[model samples]
Structure formats: C-alpha cells, structure tokens
Target chain A: MTDITNQSLSEIIDNIKTKRISSTDLTKAYIKNIESAKKLNAFVTTTFDQALDKAKQFDAKPNFDQLLPGIPLAVKDLFCTENTKTTAGSNILNNFIPTYESTVTKNLWDSGSFLLGKLNCDEFAMGSSNETSYFGNVINPVKDQLVPGGSSGGSSSALAADLTPATIGTDTGGSIRQPASFTGTVGLKPTYGLCSRWGIVAFASSLDQAGPMTKTIKDCSIMLEAMSGFDKKDSTSINKKKEQYSKNLKNNIKGLKIGIPKEYRVDNMPKEIDELWKKGKKILKDLGAQLIDISLPHTKYALPTYYIVAPAEASSNLARYDGVRYGYRSKKGKDLIEMYENTRSEGFGDEVKRRILIGTYVLSSGYYDAYYLKAQKVRNLIKKDFDDNFLKVDAILTPSTPSSAFKIGEKTNDPVSMYLNDIFTVPVNLAGLPALSLPAGLDKQGLPLGLQLIGKALDEQKILNIGYAFEKNCAFKNKIKKWW
Target chain B: MSLDKEKIKHVAKLARISVNEAKVDSLTKDLNSIFKFIEQLNELNTDKVEPLTSILNQSLRSRKDEINDGKIREKILKNSPKESEEFFVVPKVVE
Candidate 1:
C-alpha cells in the first residue's frame, strides 16, 4: 500500500473498480487512520460504522458512474449529516442531531461518497480563526504551530493532512476560502445558492453557501459538479442546469482579462505577500492573462456592511435555539423567560453572543430602517460593483486574507480585528459570486500567500480552469509538495 | 457610538441572552469600540440608495403555505436540563 492517502478519489475508485483494492479494505484503511491519529482533531465524530455499512452496500457491484463511489470524504460540521451529530463547533448544539439531511451531504452520499467523519469549525461559523470552536481547535496537520483559517478550518486541515483529500464546507464570508488559503490547498465557494442549504446549519442565511474543498482544483471541480444542483427544499437553491466545472480547465489564459483590485494592496500588508502576489501575476501573464487594474470603490466599507448584514441575519436565524426547539436549556431558571435567557446565555459562546446581540439590536423595530435596511442597500451596491466589473474581465483578483494564518490566541479576544481577517474575501460573498483560492507562493516563515479568483455567478468553471492553468504554470503544486 | 449602561442592558434583554453584571463593564466597552468603528458607514450619502438584504436580485416566488414537522423533539430535548414526555417542563407561568 503506497499510502492510499496519496491517491486521489479517481485513482482509488479505479483500483476498486479493477479489484486491485477492495472497497472494504479502503474503508478499513480510512477508519484505521481515523482511529490512529485522534490528536489531529480534524474529525469531531467519525462515521466509522456507518461508512463501513455503506462500503459493504456498494461492494456488490458498485456504480462506476459515481466518481467518488466508496471513497471516504469528510463533511464540515456546519452541514447536517442526518443521524450524525452536526455540531457547528459550539456547545449549544452538542447534542443536536437532525432527522433530515442537507442536500449537499445527501448528494455526496448518493454519489457513492462514503463518510470519513464530521470536521470541526468556528462556533456558528462566526470567527475567521478556527479557535472559536468549542470542541477545541483543529490543528493544522501540516504545521501545528499555526492556526487554521476558520470557520471551515477543519475541512482545509483534513485535506491538507490527507485525513481525506476531499470535504464539503460552507462559506458565509470567506470561511471556506480563507481556511484554504492558510492550509495551502484549493477551496471553492460556488455561486450563491449553487448548492442547496436545506440541511446546512444557518449562519448568515442570505450569504451562506456550501462548496467543496480539496487538494487540487480538479478535485474541487469534480466534487463541485456532484454537489451543485437545484433542490426544492431550499428556496434559494437556483434552477440552473448542471454544468461540468472541469470543462474549461483546458482553456488557456491567452487574452484572458484578470482584474486586480489595487485597493487590496493595503499599507499594513506584509512585504512577502506583496512579492508573492506579484509573482502570481507574472506567472499568469507568462501564460497570457492580462492583469488589469480595477477598483471596487466600496471595498473599505465591506467589513462594516458585512458585519451589519451577517449578524442581523444571524440574530434572526439563531433565534430558533430558544431551548424550545433544539439545544440546551438553563437548569436553574425560575420562569420561562429566565429559562430562555439562562439557556442561551450558557449555550452560546462569546462571539456568538456578540453577534446575536448585534443582530437583534439592528433588526429591532426602531433600528431596522437605520441599520439592517441600510446594510442591505450597501450590499446591493457592492454586488452592482462586481456586476459592473465582470463585464470588463474574466474574473477579479485579490488577496484571500490580509496575511497568512495568525498565531493562536493572537486576536481571539478582539472580535473586530478577527473580523478583518476576511476583509478581502467578504465582498465576494456579499456579491453572491463564485470564488476560488489557490496557493500563489509561500511567505518567509513558509506559510502560503493565496490568490483569489472571483467569477460571475455560475461561471465557476472559468475560474477553476484559470486556477488549474495557473497551478500548472506557476508550479504551486510543487510549492505545496513541502506541506503534504 | 457610545452605548450607556442602560442601553446595553436593553440590547442584552432584547437578544434574550443574559450577561453577568460583573462582565458588563468590559462588554459595554467592547461594544462601544465596535459601534464607533461601524459609525464610519454613517458618512456615506444614501438618500437614493435602497437597502439590499440579498445579493441575489431576484423575486422570491410565492408558494402556498404549508406546515412542516421538523422532527428533532427528542434530539432537541436531549440538551434540556429538565424534560417530560411531549413537552419541556418549565416553571409554571401563572400569577
């Protein structure tokens, strides 16, 4: 066994198809790996028995059409894997299990993808650093000293460590992209509503979307094709016909217009990051991508606008955890009101509490017009800005984060500074566009600086293809060879 | 930008979350700093700008209303400190 962790899902499936590796053997290998490295903390709960059962069911003449048939992949804790504990990194839902499945998780299983386990995330997907997770942070398998960029930190960590080469994660605002940036792997946040939300835990309803994170852009593209589709259960799920994300990978960047937001080159940006981005641009230019300067004039206001909009919606969405519906109730309350208050007070973490208060205050009767409504309007302007630029270029380029992964406990107490970690990636979510992060180059301490590509809605293939071309041209896979 | 002690209490109550009075001073300080930062948005002129809640600028389709029983009663109660069959046992509400 050449460390099956080194093989992609396609290679694994081919072996299983040719009977070179039994599906049972493959399933047992992943399970053994999960049991052996419990310290990685990647999986919150391993679906070992369930995965074995699924592998057996498929062992009798498996479906070859299902690209990932019998291959194990993790699901970020943010998604609802029916009957499995879907804790979104908070004690609030520590015991919460749903009877229904999220469409993406369900679809992943239906595509013959066997479960590896549920990965950890920031509490309620609130933090840019995975440290907010109540289940203890997901250690970067590549470098334990660094903090995994959050909210989907676990997904990226698992893929980078080869816990599983693939996983599904939700990005409300850079949760997926930023983590991928830190882990030096590929993560795609598809066009808004490309994947249904019926089963994923809600963070910011308007901005929440589920996408794939994997070792390579090609894996992301394949997983994305299997994931994106219409689901009536999710009203926001789009009705767009299924399109192969890998279809455009062969397309050259010849005459491709790549828009670079000069505004992202902030004063405090590290010199190494600046150098790496310039190098990434040079690689793209060498392969024929024209780097054009464009302005997202509203860039400065994105963090504030996102803060207002995300928390306001978060305040409403999280209101359901009133101890009546799901989650813990206060043990020492004298009345219903006290019960509600105490239960929530103890259930939610500090960042979650901060967001809920901000959300509620903004949406309350008197302030709704002043705060929530105004933020929504600015969101529209932000999207319009992107819509305007997409007509001029193939995709927008920006830094995935201000810097590479910050050290643990660096800014956890300062919520505002933590929120700034996603500044460059937030606007794309606000615009409901497709975005992908690829390793451009590494920094002085060997951390990666990632280049982000933002495409028009549903044209995920264009950017993924661009990423594939750049990956080959820039030799980022070689850069990443040091990590894996 | 400055949130007073009373207003902080109101915001906390409205959010249906309880914060310890001992910690309120620090939280209030933190909240004030954040609010001051967000107050920068007040500078933008937007007499004509409509607030946008969603990035998807499409109409929400009208669908016939129906009831759904989101089963999780047992799962939801698993976290309760005290519970009985069919309902969450709480302190009686009568005066």
Candidate 2:
C-alpha cells in the first residue's frame, strides 16, 4: 500500500504501532527492494531468511514501547555483529565472523531493531569514495558511475535507494557526512565517543565514530536517541545520561547565533556551492537566527594534520591483523614474520596499504617528532579554533563538500586530491565535535549538495534544531529520479 | 620528506606488510605526494602546545580489577584460521 518502503523510520514505527503493516510485510518489502537494486552493490551480505524469521517473531508479539518496535536495518560492515560476517570492506576480514556484538548495534537490537545485512564501505574506512572497498565501489543511486561518497557509501546508497528504512555509518573524517551529502540523505557524526568504538573495526582510534544516516532529520534524531548511550566497554563513551534528542527537537531557532566561518570559503569553490551557502544563511536569518562572521584560523592545517594522526593510529591499530588468531592468513610465507607480512599485504586493498605505509612511516623512529607529534600539536590548535568559536556562537555552518559527488574513479590516482573532499568536514572530527550534514540543494548536474552544521562538543541538539529549522524552510526538496 | 623505494620497503617491513618489487616505485611516488601535502603542517608554530592524545580531558575511569567475563574459549577459538584444540596454531618460532 503506497510503497511502505518510501515512508520514513518514524512513520514506519507508527504504522507498526497501529497494526497497519506487519513486521513481516515491512521486511519483505525491503528485501524485494534490495534484490532489485543489486546493481548499486550496496549490501556485502544479506540475511533475508533470518530477517524474515525475526520479523515473524516480532509480528507475533509486537511491542509498542520499544523505539524501533520491529524494524530491520542494514548497518555498515565496520561494526562487529555476533555470528555475522562483519567485513569492514576489506579482504582481510572477509572470512571473519565475530562472537561478540559492537556496543552500538547491541543498543539498536535492545531498541527492537534487527539486522537486514552488512553494507559495503571503504576498506578500514580509509577513502572518501567507495572505490577503496574490496567488495567493489557502490554506485550512487542518484546517478550511474557517480560514487555514493564513502566509506559509508553503501549505507548512504542503500538508504537513498530505499533498500533499508534507516541505517548507521561510521565517520572518520567525514565518512558519514560526505556520503550523506552525495546521496541526498541526513548523516551525523556525533561527538567522538558518543557511540562506542568497542566492536567496530578500528580506523584512527581518536577519530572513528558511529552515527545514524536517515531520510529525514526527525528520523535522524529518533535513530540517534536509540543508538547513543554510555557504555563501560568503550572508555571514551560519555558517562552521562542519554539525551532525548527527538523529544527536545524544536525548530524555533530564534536569536540563536550561527557562525559562518570565513576560512570555509575556500579558493576555487564552485559557484553553485557558494550560492547554496548563501541560501542557507538567508534561510537561517529569516528563521530569526543571527549570522556572525567568524574565523577558524587553523582550518587550513586540519587536513594535513588529520592525514598524519589518523594514519599513525591506523598503523598501530591495524598491526593486530597478523593472521594468527583470526582473519586471512597467507599460505606462502616461510616463517612467522613472513606470514604476517604476506597476510597483510595480500588481504588489504591498495588504499588500505597506502595508509598503512604512511602510518608506518610517520611513526618510524626518525620521523616521529617531525610528523606524528607535530601533527598532534597542530591538532590541538585545530580543536582550540572550535573551542574558542563555540564561545561566541551556538553553531557553525559551511558547505558539506567543495562540490557534489564525482565519478567513482575520478580521484583514485591522487590520494591527496581524494583527501581534499573532506576539507569542510574533517576539522569537526579533529576537534571531537558533533556535526550534521543536511541535503540542502542540487548542483548544476542535479546531484545533491549538502550544507553542514557544526556544533560544540556534546551539543548535537543545537545543530539538529538548526538543521531541522533549515530543512523545513529551505526550498530544496530531496527527490532523486530513480535510474537504478 | 619524500620516500624512496628502499625507504618504502623499509617502512613496509616495519609495518609487517610485504611490498612487491614491481609495486615499490608507484607506492613511493604516491606516498611522496601525500608527504608533500602533509609537509604544509610545518608552517604553523606549535612550540608551546601539548600534544592532544585524547579529546576528553578527564582521567580514564578505573574499575576494581576483577574477572568480568570467561567461559567463551570455544566461541573465541571458532574464528581462528588455524585452531588446534584450545589454542590458535601459528608458525613455529622456537628453533
């Protein structure tokens, strides 16, 4: 009836509460959609038979008090799901199945949501495009050949294509937000440690965070409320009580001071992006918000700093893949050391290898002071920029990316160029701040362009409110003509 | 700040990842370009700033040291590529 797959997560919850649609019916609808949209290459593994069984069990004894009730969601493969193959988009973990569940996924399951499947992502969440995934690049549902921005590319594409109602993604330097921008959806990278990194595959320990990607901001707030909490397992998790983000979401942002950082007006930015930024400002101002011109001077150093810090941590975190306890092991090695070398070299993809090499180089004895430590200090400056700016403003606004989504292989040859895709989004991660990317408008080619709202650390509610107000008032309507 | 083939090999060895002889040249070039970009951080002066190891300024929480979990030996061993009884089988180290 009227495409149950097209309804938002909140609406689906209501339909289930009212007994209008059975969980089995909802699960079947998504399965049908996912099967037809196989060309998108979004799902790495589909658990349809198990999903239907769970749905039937849910429908037999429905519970209305739970947040998700009886929803089935496909999560990004970086998370460790018990008894399920959680690949993290690398051949290294292709045959690996976990006996434990990631804290974030456990929280979702407790909220009455079950797994639909594991979605594809950049190997170890290393690249800006989905091309780095060993499972192959996920096609943007918006257009053929265009990348659905990545490591979270599969999550974004699946949501945008309506294969799953709502999904979760991990953001390390814009993995969640950038892809959300590309695919015309809502993605949030909550402050670092908001969601546990316990069972998730480690990328950069300091930067990796799990967040929700949804079709609407209200659904985003709802999914976020259900997913985030204090977990003793994740040392960095905020030990405070969970926030009632959806209930507290009020769009009246009158007199709220929103900062427009001057440094974000990067050199050679597209005219349409600039126009979108201006339009965003006007919408906020009209909604009774004050737009202050602010400066984040160290913004220029963020990407370079991130490249150093992330890879350094990544090299260390990834050293565990020795082919000893779990994952892929090479048969060709002559001895223990040789086996370790062969397994990593063979299991990892090119982008993953490049990062590992960079990580190894930066942390190497001679280069430690010049590279890793220097970047860490510069990282402090980047954080201080936001810490100082948050004093004068409630939130900061910028364009999500310099431009819209590019072709899959567009910047594969140039790592630095691909890294530049996160220019506007990286600084937030470096500072351990929360930011949301909202689909604001379309570019000249009709590809979706997003506007980012950056909030202070632990201030997700403020940005969500501003984004909610902007989403309601902005002229942009997110409609993708389904060519897939 | 650039890496040569020999240095790339050395770093690959340190990282415990094998680098094929044919791939070393391109890997060196790619890594050199990334380093070239990273070199820009040198322009900023961070002399007095302490390194940011963790974003949360609070001290790590300490819990009483005690056994919290056990009895999942089979479960943990189930994921190993080569398991022998209760342990993971590895290449022999003792000569």
Candidate 3:
C-alpha cells in the first residue's frame, strides 16, 4: 500500500472507510514517522501506547461514519489532557497533568479522533518562537535550525513533518497562524468563544483561542467542525449552534468581495511577501472574486496594544502557578511567600517572566488607566475597523507573516523584533475574528510562505470558503524535501 | 518609560517571581527597550472609544450558586507537590 502518511487526511479517511487500511496500520505508520523524526523535537511527549491501544479498539469495532474515526492527530501541549502530562512547554508545568480533558480535545475524542501525542509549544504560549519552550525549541521540519513559527511551533512542525495528519493549536496573538505560515501547514484561529477555553491552559484569556492545524484547508474545516461548540463550563463559550463549516466549504468564489488592507503594505516588507500577496489577489481575481483595497487605520497600534492587553491578562491568568497544587515547586523556600517567589522564578523562562513583569507593571495602581485601560480602548477601535470593512467585503486577505521562517536564534535577543512576527496576526485576535493561514507559495530559500484570509466575527464559513477557492487556484505544493 | 532596576524588582515582587541579582541589570535593559516600543501606542488618539472587555459583547453568564460539582478530590490532588490524605501540604502559615 502507498505510504498512509503521504496521503491527505480526507484520503486517509476514505481509505479507512473502504477497509483498504486499518486504523491501527495508519496509527503505526505515524508512530514510525514520529520516532524517526525525533530530531525535529516537535513532540513534548508521544502517547504511542495509548494511541496503539485506541487504534486496536477502533479496529475491533470499526466505525468510519464518525467525523474522525481512528484518525491519529496531535495537540499543542497547552491543552489539558487527563492521564497524560500536559505541559504548556514550561518547566512550571513540566509534570502537570489535568484530571479533566480540555473541551476541544474531548470534542475530538467524542468524534472518534485518536490522539498521537502532545506537541511542544512556547512556554505559556508567550513567545513568537518556540525557543521559550522549557523542553527545548521545536525545529522547523522544512529546514534544520529554522523555527517552525510559534507558540504553536510543535503543532505546525509535526504536521509539516507528517508525524501526524493534523494537529490542534492555540493562538493568543499569532501562535497558530504565524506558525502555520512558517511551516506550510493550514492553521485556523476560530472566533473567540467559538471553542471552549475551559480545559486549555490559559494565556491572555480574552485573546486566547484554540483552532486546528492541518495539511489542507478541507481538513481544517472538518477539524474545526468537530472541535467547536458551546460548553456551560466556559462562560465565554458561544451558545450558538456549531457551524457546518466542512459542509459549507463549496469553494465557490464567484462574486465574492475580498478586501486587501492598504496598511499591510508596511515599509521594508520583503519583496517575496509582496509578490505572494499580489499572487494571492491574482488567484482570487481569476476565480471571479472581486478584490477591493481597504484601510484599517488603527493597524499600527495593534502590536503595541496587544503587548499591553495580552500580558496584563496573562499576568492574572498565570498567577495560579504559585507553587500550590501542582507543577514544579522550588524546594529551597523558607516560607510560603519565599516558596511562591522561588517556584515562579525558577519555573518560568525568561520571556514568560518578562511578560509577567510587563503585565504587573501595566496593571499596577498608577499605570492601570494609562496602559491597560488605554490599550482596551484602542482595542475597541481596532475591532471597529474590521467591523466597518466587513460591511463591504466578504473576507480580507494579507500576508501571514512579513517573511518566511528565520533561524531559531535569529531574533531571540531582541524582544521587540521577535514580537513583530505577529504583526499581521495580532489584529485578528484583538478583533475576535476567525482567520486562516494556508500555504501561498515558497520563498527564494524554498521555505514556505502563507497568506491569511480573515473573516468577520463568527463567520468562519466565509473565510474557509474563500481559502478553499484560493487553495484550488494556487495549488501550492507544500511537501518539503526532507532534510531531517 | 525606562524601567530601572528598582522598578523591575518591585514588579517582580508583585508578580511573585524572583529575579536573580546577576540577571537584574539585563532584565532592566530588556524591560526598558520593550516599554519604549510599546509606548508608541500613546500616539493614537482614543479619547472617545469605550473599553471593550469582550468582542462578542456577551454578558457575564452567571449560574445558580450551588455545589453541583466537585467530588473527585483524588483526581484533583493527583499532581500535588506534597499531599497527605485530602490536603495539599504547604509551608505552615498559621504557625
């Protein structure tokens, strides 16, 4: 039989349904690939024993009609997985395990999906690069030493490496889309509250959202449909009915209006990124989609605003890791206060600490109104900018990142430069919008580049449809020539 | 907006995270540079916009206050650093 890992998820599903391949066989194929590609460090922990058992159970009683019956996939380590270690790629949570599974993962398991492992990510989903991971940086599968964008770096890298057909990742700023762009995988950051955040590790609660990362937009649609819904456990979980995104993804682009934001053409943008944007516009135009130039005037403030808002919320959310309950606790503390200080100081990495300090500073008594409140107000304007544009356009298009993936150590020393990696993706989170990044083409170095399709709030179908149409036209080949 | 060493130490205390004495200088420099970058947001005029706490405008959903959940004390304490019976052991506060 053909290499099961090489086929698209949809094809693999069909193969399983037709009895051409057993779920166990497919699971083993992925396990072998994951074992061989250990140098990529995509996985913080692999659940091969559990996965093989699940595959065998599924084989004993096959049910291919379910959404993802026996389909092996991975999840970013941020999600809480019961009976398994669920580190948010931080030493603070190095041995932390949730007694309860995250609602997103529970939804997948309920749909008969199989879990391959917990993929690595940035510590507490803080950094733009996965270097913040206490477990170590997840290398880009496309080329050695290059970062597979983050804080969902491991999810993107694993999918790109074919360790698993699909994976799940969280995006606070650009964790999902940026990494997807970097690794040539499709990642969708669903609308805020679209997927329950109850069991997923919190990072900037308001901006944090869980979404799917897959090799194809169709797989993204299917995964999103299975993973999203209302949950009473989470107050922010949207109460509306789950969208039938996969069913609605007809790839019909005729007469659709796609906005190209003028402010995205920033100064010093790489020439390759500009060319990719133009190529995306041309592809959409060729498919009968009308392209319109638009303006998001508050775009320049987005990154700074995100810096304040995300860290402020993260500081509050992460305050729970104070040497109580679980995770790493410093053993050399004299008392409770010292214990809390020691645990956090030793537990968190540099980037996580910096964000916490910034958060504490912003939310402090004297600076609250000036930084936190002001950032929130600016966030409103940014949301309004998107709301106004969506009135005239079905979706918006922009380059996923300013450029392709860079080396892992390239921007680690400069926090501001590292933060700029999310320049294009932050606004979407600030606006609580659903957006997707799919492979557009490769850059001069043969590294993959992606273009983002942003949709109005809760209107994920429109963006998925547009992406489906564009994917057909672009026919971007993303399979990397394995250097690992 | 330049974060001084004292300011960094104060903020770290407030955050309950320790900053090594040796690392304090570099940490101060990093914070100062990051703050300088973020201060650019002051340029945007935003005197009239309301602070948006949630983009969906969903009101805080409250349910009846009742003990409908919580019984699996064992599962909850599975990861405790030091546990005995149903209690997590921490440095004594009362003493």
Candidate 4:
C-alpha cells in the first residue's frame, strides 16, 4: 500500500472517489500515523474510533456529491463538535462536550468530511505560542521541541507533519497565518464574516475568523469553499453570494496590483525576512503584476489596538464560562460569588487570566473612554488605512512574521516580546480582511519563513489567485524530514 | 497609566476572577508594561472618529422575537457540571 498519510488532501479525495483507496483503509493509516506522532502533542483529543466508523460508513455507500466524502481532517479544538470534547486548549473546558456543532465544523461534515480528532491550540486562542494550551505545548514537526506558532499551533503542526491531511483553524490575531508560516503549511484567515462564527468558541468576537490550514493553496481553497456560508445563528455572518474560490484561482497575475507597505519595514527584523519580502514582490512583478510601494501610516498601532479589542471581547465572551453552565467549576467555594471567582481562578491558565484582567480594566468605568473606546476608534483608523490602500492596489503583500519559528520556551517568560510576533499579522485582522501566509523561503536555520497576501474583504479569490501564481512560480520547498 | 497592585486586584474582582496575592505583583507588572505599550495610541489625534463596534458595516437583521429555540432540555443540560432536573445547579445565590 502506498503511504496514504503522505498524500495531499486533494489526492486523498481523488483516490477515495476512484476506489483506488477505500476511506476505511486511508483513515486507518492516518490513525496509525497520529498515534505514532503523539510526541508532537498536536492532537488534544483523537476520535480514532469515531473516524474509523465514519470512514466505514462512507465506504459502505460512497456519496459522489459530497465535497469531502470520507476524508479525515483534524478540527481546531476551538470549534464546538457535538458529543466530542471541545476543550479550546483550556482546562476550564476540558470536559466541555457541546450539545450542538459549530457551523464551520457542521459545514465540513455536511461535505462528508470525517473527523480525525480535535487539534490542540492556545488556551481560548490567546497566546502567540501554543505554550498556553492547558493540554501542554504542541511540538513543531520541523524541529524537535520547537514552537509551532499559535494560537492555532496544532492545526499547523498536524498539516505540516502530515498527521492529518487538512485542518481548520481560527485566527484572532495571527493565529492561523503565523503558525502556518512557522510550520511551512498554508493558512488562510478569510475575511471577517466569510465563515460563520455561530458555535466556534469565541475568543474575540469582532476579530476571530475560522479558516483552513492545508499543505497546499489548492486544498485551502477547496476546504474554504466547503466551510463557508451565511448562518442566521451568527449575526456577523455576511449574507453574500458565495464565490467558487477554487475554480476562480487564476494562475495568471497579469496587471494585478500588489502593494508593498513601507510601514512593514520595522527595526531589528531578520535580514532573511526582508529578502523574502523582496523575493515575493519580484515574483509578482515578473508575473506582470504592478508592485506599488504604499504607506499604511496607522499600521504601527495595530498590535496595541488588537490587544485592547481582543482582550475586551474575550473577557466579555469568556464571562459565560462560569461554574453555573457547562464548563468546569471550583470544588472549594462557599457561596455563588466565591464559586465564580474560584472557578475562574482555578480553571483558566495564567495567560487567559492576564487577558481577562486587561480586558476588565480597559472596560471598567474610569478607563473605558481612554482605553477601550480609544482602541475602537484607533481600530477604525487601521481599517481606514487598508480601505484607502485597496482603492489603488488589488492586494497587499508583507512578511507573515518578523522571522521564522522560535524555540518552545524562547519568549514564554516575556509576554511583551511574545506579543511582538504578531506585529506584521494583526493589522489584517483589525481591518477584517482576508489574508494568506505562503511559504516563500527558508531562513539560515532552514526554518520556513513566509510572506502574507492581504486582500480586500470578500476578495478571497483575488488573494488565492495571487497566492496560486506565487506557489506555482516560487516552488518554495519546505517539507520537513520525519523525525518522529 | 501604570497598573499597580491595588488596581490590578480591583480589575480582577470586577472580572469575577480571584488573583492570588503571590501572583498580583507579577500581574501588576505585566499589565503595566502592556498598558504602557498601548499608550502609543494616544499619540494619534482622533477628534471625530467613530468607535468601530462592527468591522462589517452591516445592520443587525431582526426577526419576530419568539421562542423558536431551546426545547431540548435534556441535551442542553447534558454537560452541566451540576444540574437538578432541568435547571443548572450553582452555589446558593439567595438566602
């Protein structure tokens, strides 16, 4: 038998359709692979029995119409999977098995995708590194014990390691793209409201968007097409006619205007990242795309604004996780007040608690106007920067992170330094635009460094098309040597 | 705008989270640094900018408010840490 686990998602789907590989056999191979790669800690919960059973179910009666019939894929634990434990990589919800499915996951299953397991992530999608995951840190497949960028770290790790063919991830601030850049996988943080946020565990209501992480851009487009739709359940879900992004991925980039923001040139950035950005611009330029040097003046303040807005929303959203409902509660509480306090104090990790405190402080009476409201207004300015740029350029290109993946415990002690990793990626989230991280080149350490393509809201196809053109031309080779 | 221990404790209290005394000193430091970092936003002059609550500038679509959901009492209560019949159990709120 061929190495089914090594096959790209599209290839796996094709093989299943042609009866060259039965869904059961393919799923069994992945289950074996996932079990052997346990040291990576990519998966928080493995639905092996469920996956095998689902594969068997699909094999019994193959459905040709289903987009991902019998294909095993890992879901970020952030998405609520009914009856399956959806921890969101936090101890607070370690036993939180939802009674309903998140719309994104529902869309995937409706397309005949079988669940391999719930992938690990940062706690409530808070940290830049997966270290904050209550389940423990996800090990990078590229190097032993290196950090897979987060809060969607496991999603990126699994895709890069080929433990699962494809996975879904949510990006609040660089969660999807940074990890993808770190692990040498492709991640797309689609335009806000592109995918419904109906039942995905809310981190930052305004910023969080569910997107796909895959080995190839083509797989990303297909998975994205399957995963997106408007839902009445999510008030923010955009009710626009969906585009066939996969079909519209034009390999030609002739006359496409790509913007290179001057503001992305920060102090003390790795020289390789600058070279990679230059390389990306050159590739687009060679393809007959006009590379314009533009200025997003408000870009410098994006991170600070993101920290304020995300934490504020997160604090509000996470307030529902008190001991009263479905999540964990403290065992040593004397009264309701004490119970609430104890439950949160005990259940949440330090990073999560810190964010909650920051959120509460900002939204509190005295500082609301100065901090929370000011952040919101500044957020508008950030969005306006992109809005103004989009009138001139079709898409914007920049470095995904300042550099490649760092070691597991590199910046864990310093929260501010860890937050700086998001400097390049947060602006897109703040502006509610779709963006993708493409592996452009590798650094001196042989670690994957990536470039981002930011597109106007609902212009996912444009970015995908641009990314496709780059992928075909650049041919960035970053397949990791199997160490496990 | 440096966050001190007292202010951090107050914020924690408002958030309904208990921060241990041992951790308060460090939490104060973390918040102060983060706050100091975000103070850069004050440099930009915004006299008339509106606070952007929603990124997708859309109106909230409303339907006739009615009891269309929540009939599955058993399923909804399935994951409750403490429940009695159909109600979620919590620490006593009233005497």
Is candidate 1 or 2 superior in DockQ? 2
Per-residue lDDT of A1-484 in model 2, one digit per residue for the tens? 7999999999999999999999999999999999999999999999999999999999989888998999999999999999899899999999999999999999999999899999999999988889999999999999999999988999999999999999999998999999999998999999987888889999998999999999999999999999999999988888988999999999999999999999999999999999999999999999999999999999999999999999989999999998988999999888899999999999999888999889988989988999999999999989998989889999999999998999978999998999999999999989999999999999888999999999988999999999889889985666776787
A best-first ranking of the candidates according to their lDDT comes to 2, 3, 4, 1
DockQ of each: 0.56, 0.87, 0.85, 0.84
- Backbone clashes in candidate 2 total 0
Candidate 3 segments exceeding 4 Å error: none
State each candidate's chain A TM-score: 0.96, 0.99, 0.99, 0.99
Candidate 4 C-alpha lDDT tens digits along A40-82: 9999999999988898889899896777978988989999998
Task: Score chain A of model 4 by TM-score against the reference chain A.
Answer: 0.99
TM-score of each: 0.95, 0.99, 0.99, 0.99
lDDT (C-alpha, whole model) for all candidates: 0.82, 0.93, 0.92, 0.91
Q: Model 4, clash count?
A: 0
**A179: Cα error in model 2, Å:** 0.3
What 10-residue stretch in candidate 3 chain A is worst by lDDT?
A475-484
For model 4, what is the alpha-carbon lDDT of residue B54?
78
The residue pairs that clash in candidate 1, if any, are A102-A199, A376-B51, A376-B52, A377-B51, A377-B52
